[model samples]
Target: MIRVAVVGAGLVASHYAAGLQRLKRAEIEPYGVPLAKFKVIKDYVEEEVVSAYDVDANKVGKPLSEVVKRQLEGVVPVPPDVPDFEVREGVLASSGAGLDKMFPVRGRDQKLPLKEAVEEIAKEFKSDNVNVVLNLISTEPAEPFGDEGKLAKALERGEVSAGQAYAFAAYLAAKDSGKPVAFINLIPTPLANDPAFVKLYEDANSLVLGDDGATGATPLTADLLEHLAERNRKVRYIVQFNIGGNTDFLALTIPERNLMKEKTKSSVVEDILGYDAPHYIKPTGYVEAIGDRKFVAMDIEWITFNGLVDELIVNMRINDSPALAGLAVDLVRLAAALLEKGVKGTFYDVNAFFMKNPGPKEARNKARIKAYYDMISALRELGVIVE
Candidate 1:
């Protein structure tokens, strides 16, 4: 079994927990999960969320079903089989400010020493035999610790971000248990990209697989850029923005928090187009009424043959949280299978397809179409996928 632990019990986590249970019960088809049609080393039924953590005062100590019901009551049916484990208090570290604006914040770090809190969380992972730990917290402002010594110093000073703290806890869990763990980061913090964290996971014989999930507008924008690039279209300029009502969007209203999304979202332009296209791509606003379905608008102008200027405009309303939740379903199983195959450290092929900024610090973004085939090919060669 691929036992999993969730780091945040927010909207996305609610969707993931509820949707996963429904998938297991065969109550709904796995329509949104990308690799559901393919045969993978780990079956979807083998995946289970054994534990979850959160820093919100309202969420901590509450059952996941209760949290899912509170967030998804009328929106979607809360799965009756969703895990009943209490959501433990997670680390706050440098992430408290933005989260504090949304709800009452209380992290284990606030009550115990930061390291002790991490150890406590790690103990749970070891006890639960968690093979995959998903970081689905709201975006927070953070910089990479390029060196292991620097990371250790930051942890000692309690200056690490919440993602970093939880990553360390997973590392500790792997080290103590002598079992491999996959820390799948679905947030913007730099675990997969940071050499320090990558090396740390390598030492623990574990894996770290992200920087940011490529869920909504960013992946679509990437493929459009690729289409333009392949057709030899000289892109004049591109503009893309999203506005939503989720707590994540509200968190982005903070300048620093928003900048984190900008870095991950904007990287696709330069990486895929082979030149930095003049573009504005990021979350622009938060409207409470818009809820989890976000509004996306994109405009691109390009120079065609005969000095002609052509323009393309696209608009969409995307279910933001459930989209990532679907991706999480695949990632959890993939992470466990990769670990079982003795693939430690970070894997770029998987990250390239799933993450906005695929990691190991040097990887670049690729169009989702090409990335999808390339990742499938790689996984096949590794015996992680069949047929």
Candidate 2:
């Protein structure tokens, strides 16, 4: 029985929880282990919904059933049985770094300080036996100063109110626990990218991979356009307009953090075209506050030898969290697979599919992602990977 723990319990986390349910009927090997050993074990097919935790007051301490119940009360409803786990209290930290101003400010009474909140989360994971932490917390503008290491050290040395310290502390606990922690940052944070933080996760035998969720709009547009423009045609201009009302777009609207979003949106097209892609690609604005729904627009112009011009425009809409749900399901399964095989450190193949912006962005092969996923799916079919 492999114990799987969900850390966020947010919109996307629920998707992960739901995906786990969908994956329940499918038999997949845990991580790196071959499927041959488990092929004959019919009883190892159980997919247990162990735990779900979040910092929201409405969710903290609630039974998983009740949490699912309340989440349905929102405009966007979730299936009653989607999350079949216990929803516990997660670390609730005070919104520092001026991020709270972006949304309806959290009431002072609802927020918890950094140390207290992190300790609460550590205690929950330790008590619950959670194997993976999928950080689906609300996005914040990129930290203006890339000083997470210095700040983490400072917090460890003394007391720090900022959540950065608590986050680092959580990483530290996961690393030293021998539990093979895997940090999947759906938001753009410096935890994995920072040299100091990377060293910490590495030394602790935990895998830290993130930077972006790569959901659908930005990366999909970049990929399709890049392929189109690379067909021996003279390319001229490209404009990608993405609009959404999720926490992700709201967070990026903060001027200070636009750079991270820009870098992510740019890299997708740039990687494919094999040249600098001059384009406008980013989250334009928020609309309706409709949970996790998003709308994307893509426009391109290419010229012909006869001085003729061709223009292309595309519109794409998707449920952001559910799209990511499948990916997250595969990710947790991969993490559990690695743990079962006693494999540690970075798992590049798993990262490639799950993260939009990975640590080694330059080493990715998009063509091979589907083949790798096929192998994973095949292993599951053979009853080799179980969570």
Candidate 3:
């Protein structure tokens, strides 16, 4: 069975759990999953959320199956069998301090050293089963804890991001158990992209997939650019942005946090176009009433066949979290399958298509699709997927 651990038992995590349930029951009309033929859904139904972590006092000690009900109010139905495990406290740095004003979040009553915290959480799920660490925490700006030496020193201050600490924990757990593990980063943190962080994961033999999930506008934009590029269309300028009312949006009202979101959202633009096109792509605002459904608008202006100025305007209202949750299902399953094939570190085949800022920073969408097909072939070769 594929066991999973969630870094935060928040809305997106809940949506992911719900999506898993749909797959378990063979009901998936709700999640508009864009996969061509995910024969892995059956394998995914074997999944179980074995552990979850959160700093909210109310959530820390509760059963994940129970606490995630809060997310049900947001509209996704929760599965009764998602499994209930005690939510543990995760390590958090100043980046999380800002959220306290908005929600009642409290990390370990007593701050634990970084290594201690990593070990603390790692001990819970170190069995022989495959594990995937999913980080769905609110977006926040953070720097890598750095090399093992620097991370060791930083831990002395007991200030490390939920992303870094959890990643380190997965590495330790994978090393100790000699089991294949994966860290699926659904937020805008750089675990997979950070050089020092990737080295740590690679050294420990754990697969790390991350940066930011490309569920809505971002991935769509990549494809649009690829279509233009393949057809030899010159792109003049593009404006892409989204606004939503999720707790994440509330946290992003902070400029530092918004900048973190901006960097990932814009990371794909120039790469797919082969050069930097003037673009303003980022989270433009927060509208609480809209909740998890985000409004996305994009205007692409480009030069056409005869040097004529043409524009492509698109708009969408998407249930952002669920869109991401759908991709999460594929990522975790793919990670488990990749590990069985002796591959490790960043899997751009999945990351490039599934993430906003895939590791290595750039990929054209058409190339990503080809890589994705190649990955599927590899999976079939390894018996990870079958018709």
Candidate 4:
């Protein structure tokens, strides 16, 4: 069983916590392969919210299960132990890169330094393994420091973002344990993609995967691009965006933060299409009236065989937080299982299929398809579950 310590125990995490508990019941997975490996997902995979951190006063000292019910307005299905699982105080480093306009801040007196933060969090669990540290924090202002030396210096000066702080802590804690652990980023900020952070994880021989979790529009777009390319269609331009009412959308209203999200969303086009496709893709705006449901719009215009102009216009309204959280469940388990075998760094199999701009990206459709199968094989080889 994995004792997960979730940072930013907010909207998305409510869905992640509730969804994992729900999936623990016997049921068929709606998608993906290696059904043989997935058959025992419940038995080999389980999560206890050993600790959670959020700046919101209502959430910080409460049970994760109790908080999720309020977040989703009684729509969450929480397990018995979940209600007793305490939500610890979280440090909003630099107030989460100035996101206080949307999220609250916990007291400085209650938090510790980067290394102590990990040790303190580690002490919260009775489970032998800390398993994985999942960062579900909102979009934040970030800059890739280029190398470990600069990143370490910046971290010492407390100039890093909230997401970076949590990642550093997770790596340190795993190193201290002298056992396998993982850090999974479900947000758009760089963790796995950052060279400095990747180096840190490798030095510790732990797993770090993500930059952002691709749930709806992004993955669909990737597959569609593959279809057009295989058919030898020349793409002209594409436009896609999502507007939602969640706290994350509110946080993205900041230009610096929005730029971070846009980078991840837009990064896929050039690599996948084989040439730069003039595109506009990002989290466009926040409409509080929309609540957790997100509004997505896309326009793809391209040249097909024989000089014909074809345009694909699609509109969708999806339940955003829950969809992304469902993807996170699989990634966390994959990271945990891989770390057990001393496999560190990123997994393109999990990254390409699950992330928008997977690291060292395998943007081609054929490669992504193969990556999915490879992920199943890797999981099965670990024997975490059996058919």
Model 4, 374: alpha-carbon shift in Å?
4.3
Please report, in order, the local distance difference test score of every candidate based on alpha carbons: 0.92, 0.56, 0.76, 0.72
Clashes of each: 0, 9, 0, 0
TM-score, candidate 1, is: 0.99
Clashing residue pairs, backbone N/CA/C < 3 A, model 4: none
Better of 1 and 4 by lDDT: 1
- Poorly placed runs, candidate 3 (over 4 Å): 27-31, 34-36, 127-130, 144-148, 157-159, 361-371, 381-383
Top lDDT model: 1
Cα TM-score of candidate 3: 0.91
Worst 10-residue lDDT window, candidate 2: 32-41
Q: Pick the candidate with the highest TM-score.
A: 1
> What lDDT does candidate 1 reach at residue 356?
92
Could you give candidate 2's per-residue lDDT for residues 1-387 as a string of tens digits? Answer: 545555555667665554455445443333322232433222223334577655555666667766654543554434446644556654434233445464323322245655545656666666666666666665544342235456555454434332344345446567556665666666665455455555666667766666566677655564565466556556676787777776566666776556667765566555556665578877777785645678878888877567788888888787877667556555555556665555445555555555665554334424223524654664465444553
Assess the local accuracy of residue 220 in candidate 4 as a C-alpha lDDT between 0 and 100: 76
* Model 1 score (lDDT): 0.92
lDDT of 4 at 219: 76
Give the per-residue lDDT digits (tens) of candidate 4, residues 60-153.
7887878887787755546554445767776666535565566566733245664455345555422436778888877787776768899878
Select the stronger candidate by lDDT from 2 and 4: 4
lDDT of 3 at 286: 87
